[model samples]
Target: MLAFGCTWLYDGAMSRSDRFEIFLAAPPGLEEVLTDEAREMGFGPVTAVPGGAGLTGQWTDVWRANLELRGAGRVLARIGSFRALHLAQLDKRARKFDWAAYLRPDVPLRIEATCRKSKIYHAGAATERIARAITETLGAPIAEDATLRLMARIEDDLVTFSLDTSGEPLHRRGYKEAVGKAPMRETLGALFLRQCGYDGAEPVLDPMCGSGTFVIEAAEIAVGLPPGRARRFAFEDLAGFDAEAWQAMQTPRPPRDTPLRFYGSDRDAGAVRMAGANAARAGVAALTKFTCQSVSALTRPEGAPGLVMVNPPYGARIGNRKLLFGLYAALGEVLRREMRGWRVGLVTSDGGLARATGLPFLPPGPPVAHGGLKVTLWRTGPL
Candidate 1:
């Protein structure tokens, strides 16, 4: 809920000498989008890894990442890594590890562990060993409901420890309390926007705006707002956190604006109303418009050609998925007839639903997980 001045944060950026590994998580298929965003936000040198991007920076960098990056699901600070052949070795190394470097002795920590191709194959036991180390040596208590979580990952006998700096996933944004079934995660929506080549200069229209995530995100992008500006992060509880420095880093900037407006249309009237309310909560209401209307009734507003991104129902769970193809085709017919010159980004778990749209789409992006379904972003050039 606070901000820092650009100067103060950048100074911290240059001031840190002890750089730790910072990993920014993204949806599986959208790692590249997060990588691009990380570089654009000045986190470098960044390497695009399998699940996210890896970079090295000081604790200040860790806080800034949790504050600024819109595309990352979570920001993890890789505290340290070591080799451990078994549980006793892990316990010995963990006991010696400098937990004070990141965790505060007074703060409770929740530990999560994962093991793969490692001699210490029991992840739960590994977690308990690390938890005991922190408790017995560092004096921090283990708690089931702790706000701060430490992740212990043992892969191929290498025990790597990381702190979940972002607390709740970044996409929660602490503002969107109103979401319909299959609500697109704000982080996922932001990545999809990037994949669609939206730089926030263009107007965006989400035809099936269940909770208006796409429209709100587009407006936020256009206005240069920090997605985490309204939320608290786990990093605030770490030993390295500086309240003054962080506040300075979060210094408020004048809200940026664009002349172009983003729009969303949904047939569910209550959803339309909720989206509008959510937009106001996010401080993007002035630049965004939500309406209760069917896709068949969608019309292009008076403006330059932009992008029309949609996340329509594909019946992945309960409904007759076959019938949804006709809906896709109808929505495509609407865009094809009404929205010439505007690019399209459609999210659906079913490729057939995408193909049914009949819009001239390029190959889809990689499959991304959404509400237990694997979906991809299908794109098109200016239609």
Candidate 2:
């Protein structure tokens, strides 16, 4: 027999009256960074928790969050919760809850359940009861391949449900179909740029420029382009989705006028080509320049000094460990000699490698888990 779990219950069309708790997922150790972004984007009264940030908002906020926020992995809307000390109690409560209010009878449903320190300890049994209740009561079909996902967590005799409002992770910003080795995620790139005090008023340079993630992100921010503009979200599939309102909300912000052009350089011709193509797809081609050149050949662009950001090979995943020291030292020497007034933000897993740069980095930010390695952002004032 298939076990089941339940999702959110809403009264009707999502409106201001349908206020709920929203969770914005983030990378571990970067919760505070995401919080700052949410607050700046006008999303809170926000609070940072272990995995992400939380805020109380209505359905419009959820739509705006999916449309605008650049740092969240996905948005989860808390539906409701109840106490179910045992499987029987869970079955009864799930059946009686108003599943039909939010879930459509025709749309297939998928549920994930977790249990911790609860008398209804068997997650499978709890899931089965809830699933049965929804299927029997609401007549919604259950399918593993369903795009709409509901999460039910049972902790300390309390079962809380949340609906995943974003389908794909926000990092897949629907652009940059091409990526190089160990490319930085677009979400992390945005938050890191924020951490480095980049506000899109100045140019950005990435010497390694793996697929031009940082350069494109900076250009998009400068032009006031919403990150989710190119993609569809899971929220569109939910009941009460206002298609007209969402379309009106996405009316493009007027492109800002800036004289600066973002820059990226790589020794690999293929990487340079890939980065250029990605920038074009992201609609920032005119504001970005990619060149095939090594770090040794990198030069300060012809403009006011700006931020120099790079996520180079961490040796754990990309290059030889011992030889990377020379690369970092050489990068440090180049920046110190040529880029006198520029600020720098370097992301790497090794403190020693960061030290090898010999730049006057103030201090390292919190470690961020990326691709099985804990990476930290090392920043410096004007060089």
Candidate 3:
């Protein structure tokens, strides 16, 4: 599987403006949605791959993606690649790699490796080789707990090196200090909202909102707030990061004066309180409203009809499987009876539970991995 005459090696003298491959890690089943976002955001030559979206961009594009894109779960910068059939070959080539070009010698790094369809079968041994090479050749210390990670993927006898530009998963979003059980991730919520045709122009409501993810995300989008504005990234520790430029690029955009309001309601008063606190931390409390109420009490907010997005309790994660059917039926009945012109997007793992809602759902979207179960987004036309 080795390509004997081809090599993509990093040059230490390459400037930040030089173009290279950047991969935006996508949540399972959400690659297309992310690709569309990257295209709309003007990332060039974007393509949807198996697990992520691939694009060619400069360092600034990397920074902008980490700062702006909502659907991307993480960003990886693919610096270079080489052919290595075995451990000794990997060691030989890795020791000669230009690690100093991107990584700071004073900063600690963690190496992770994956092996597939290659002779270098031991991921641990491969990681040890790469780590030792970086330490001996470039003086970078390897650490287990370091936020900056260098990922090595050995597939088809090719060793490709990528830096995890995002230290933590993008879902953290830095504002959610409190989360309820089975909370939906902000990244996944954003993608679902995109699939539902939400463009920040209309109001949003979540009946089973946990931690107010949907409500806060919708509000932030409406107000033109970037998702990564409240957080730090691993790219700041790279060798060539420009703090002044990054700060300048992120000069806060005055939130547009959106008259729209986002809403979340939950039966658990504690969840409601947590959602409010999270909204406050995200700087969107003024645009969001949270309440403690059951699904039966859900009423249409006074405004133009918008999307009603919900992630209800599924049997696998929440409570008794048999009892959730009644809950689903009740939710369906309420939307049909009360929400006459609003569209509905329901996320659940059990098709039976989704069907129990009795909503005239269009075809379901791809199954997404959530809380260890595959959940599908079920959508319906205006009810």
Candidate 4:
């Protein structure tokens, strides 16, 4: 056991220079996909972890992470790491951390802790201890409902702490005021696009476009829109954040008006309406066409071949799964008959439904954990 003392105190100062290790959390199977995206955005020494990736860089790199990197759910900057055998040790080391650099008395914050295979078996007690230390020592208040959340994890006597820079999950891109039943997340949609080899130059289609997630995300990618353009991030509230630099980073660009670059169709009129509303909010309504039509009614645009991405319903709820199998079959028939030579990416949690497609199955990449279910992302063609 470690003794608790007032020797650990923070004066709320900023260091002139520091480098941070960011652990980006992703959906189960998209670690490699996110690691590649981090590398493309200039993050170095990227490595894939179980649920995410790790990268090392400076504060500017953190800013760029908020600007770019669409595949991540949240970017967590590791603030402190040390070995702690019990609650006393955990509290002592957490107090010694330089919390004053990132937190302020005026800015509200909260801590979430998880313990595994360590002497500190109770997660709630560990979280309370650390929260009390920051509050009592650093003069930072403990907010019960703070948007900026810090995560603490203790495994094998090693404690690691991180601040979540992205407030909510990055998938809530702010344009989606409404959502369809069993809707896909925008971050997962972008990763599926990359899996299908979508480069934003080719046309994209979503036969079962729900709330226009895949279609709108594709249009935004094609037009070079930043994923985080519409919302505020937690980093904006940090101590050393440069408001002027952030404002300059928000330079508005004109919308792309390319015809048929994106197309979407849904059998439900309500879904089509919601999709159009979402597209209008995203400033890409002109570039996308959402129609109330079934998969059989889907037609190719007057242009070169593009990719078709679909997240068809699996029978997850009562009375829906059985009916959706036929729907998936119909979708496969339509794609096979009408969409030959166009690539296809389908996301579903049911293997039986995927086998029913009758289309030649290219083995799925990896299973992604979505909505508490393991879903496979299947891809076929360039045909």
Candidate 5:
């Protein structure tokens, strides 16, 4: 599921009064970046944990995080936690837990459980117990494909329960139905924009635009659009999901009136057309221009220098590694000669490919796992 700040229907509705612990899951090495975004978005007392970021907020914050946060893969609302050493203790505690606080008796449910270094190592057994407890106490049915998931993790004898409030990853952004080979996820694209100092005040250009992920994301950020606005969320099915309040919360903000148009170009005409369609669906076509052009023919747009970012094809996913060097070299040469005062953010899986750019990029960032390949962002100051 995905969304944006534009108006959409409140299909799922409920009501709740619990103070939920919202966990915004980020990529493995980008926890700090996600945390900074949460803090910048006015989330209170946020904490960056090992695999994700943690914070305390109301149900509205949970909805806002899913709607507004571009960097979070998915948001998990932690309902409660306790210490249970064995299966009997787990069953006893599960029975006493207040399932009605969050879940509705009519909606179907799904349970996912994990155990690590704990006495109760049987994940399936734990799921069964929890399912039984919910069925007996609250009356929600269990289904394998239910969108509302109750996730339980037992570690060091501590049982933690969380609900998958964001049904699908936020990177979907409810637009961009068409994608090119090895397209960059929108969540990662948002962080890469941040890493390269993109503040939505300047124009952004992506020569190897693919389906125009970078350009569209830049336009959305500039206009204050939330990533979840165009789609419904799983949270709407839970108890206490005020539909009218959420609709009010997701109303579009006044867009910043910047004449600077974001630009994206691809050698494939089909990719360029797909990008244009996606930009239109995202409500930013007026502020973006996608063209069918190759990197060799790319010229600086008619405006002040802005961000020049690209997520090129990786060797593992596409063509041979050797042929890409010339492509990278040509890309580097074009930018260095024409786009003065422009910043660059290049995402690549191979260090050799990045060096081929020769763009005066500083040391690359920590390796991030994407599409099963370790990738990193190579950045450059004004060139």
Candidate 6:
């Protein structure tokens, strides 16, 4: 039991349809993509928000979101929502909303507040006001640095508060001990895999598999491995986290032993080693086979024609564009020579480099933000 202001509440046992609200955050322009992912993972009535989506479901739904949603960066539990016209109104409402139900007094917590198009225009002052209110009303000490964070967003006079169920970003799957100079996030890798229509049935190859993200994500998807299986989530420390239920949801059974359907090769041997280690941590090393080879040395695996996806180094970070044009030309030559009839997806920040591949791609769609750079996923082969 915990007490906040005059309202004290006990931790109630959760039911199957307890109506837990989840707020899913994503990169810009990925709200709809994440919403669709939530619905596919059994979340109902998913509604899109500014930087995320909201859905109503149970703890199991939360588990599913954490495990399966590919485009989401973080999933938060909506604790409360209201409209606040002033600091007093916000403080009074916050005191009455039963924060004790979600947080423990002994556990250190931090408050993060954002104000936009509201009466409270000063974000820093507003944050301080709310923090003081919570501390004074609830008698809970506010630590400057706390692992448990309560996020508050004020949009058009409406205040939405949520608990970050994912402390670290969900993409840090605790696999890649070493990352390349420019590495793709694990969530983006998974989403791109889904966008490319990779079902794990055929051979999947990433010719320029830096840090092996695409290849590892493909192996996980192919083997039905849950993306969060290798990581610890913030929800694990919440009041009513069910460890047993979470453990039971781990992949259910061993990966189905398919042939060498996942393959990755890179010109950098160090990247190859890192990829192998990441694959091993993901428990998909058996499904994936990595080699220290260049794009020119690419070979098609012995299986049904499948996806050939690559996130070649763009000039934005590593590799000079002038030098990469030759590399892209070599890749184009290799793809034309070896990988006919195989679907191809390329992620690049530069249109010229993508065009250099000469794969007859569909017109590039709107850019998606990746690592502070605007990038697009260009697809070719059979629409």
- Evaluated at residue 193, the lDDT of candidate 2 is 96
TM-score of each: 0.93, 0.94, 0.96, 0.92, 0.94, 0.90
Name the top lDDT candidate.
3
Candidate 6's displacement at residue 100, Å, is: 0.8
Candidate 3 Cα deviation (angstroms), residue 375: 0.4
In model 3, the Cα lDDT at residue 226 comes to 96
- Pairs in clash, predicted candidate 3: none
Q: lDDT by residue for model 5 over 1-383, one digit each (tens)?
A: 11111121112222355455678888777888889999999997888876668887788888889998989989987777778899999998888887887899999999999998999999999999999999998999999999888898887787877789988777888888999898899999998898888989899999999899999999988888887879878999988678899889977788778778999999999999999999999999999999898899999899798999999886887899889899989988999998999999999999899889889999888888898898899999999
Mind sharing the TM-score for model 4?
0.92
Which candidate would rank higher by TM-score, 5 or 6? 5
The residue pairs in collision within model 1 are: 3-250, 3-251, 4-248, 4-249, 4-250, 4-251, 5-248, 5-251, 341-383
lDDT of 1 by residue, 28-55 (tens): 7777789999999998988788788888
Cα lDDT for residue 38, model 4?
Answer: 84
lDDT tens per residue, model 6, 10-129: 234234356766778876666676777777777778877767777776667777787777677887776666778888887777766666666666677888888878997777877787
**Residue 377, candidate 3: alpha-carbon lDDT:** 99
Better of 2 and 3 by TM-score: 3
What is the per-residue lDDT of model 2 for residues 1-383, given as tens digits with 9 covering 90 to 100? 10123334433334436667888998888888889999999998998888888888888898899888988888998877788888888998888877765677788888889999999888888778888998999899988888888888888787887888887889999988999899999999998999999999999999999899999999999988999999998878776678899999998878888888999999999999999999888888999999999999988889799999999897897889899999999999999988999999999999999999999999799999999999999999999
Count backbone clashes in candidate 3: 0
Cα TM-score of candidate 1 = 0.93
Q: Local error of candidate 1 at 303, Å? A: 1.3
* Residue 349 C-alpha lDDT in model 2: 94
Superposed on all Cα atoms, the candidates' RMSDs to the truth, in angstroms, are 5.4, 3.6, 2.4, 4.3, 5.6, 4.7
Q: Can you write out model 3's per-residue Cα lDDT over 174-194, one digit (the tens) per residue?
A: 999999999999999999999
Q: How well is each residue in 3-24 modelled by candidate 4, as lDDT tens digits?
A: 0111222333336365557778
Give me the runs in candidate 2 sitting further than 4 Å from their true place: 1-16
Cα lDDT over the full model 6: 0.76
Off by over 4 Å in 3: 1-14
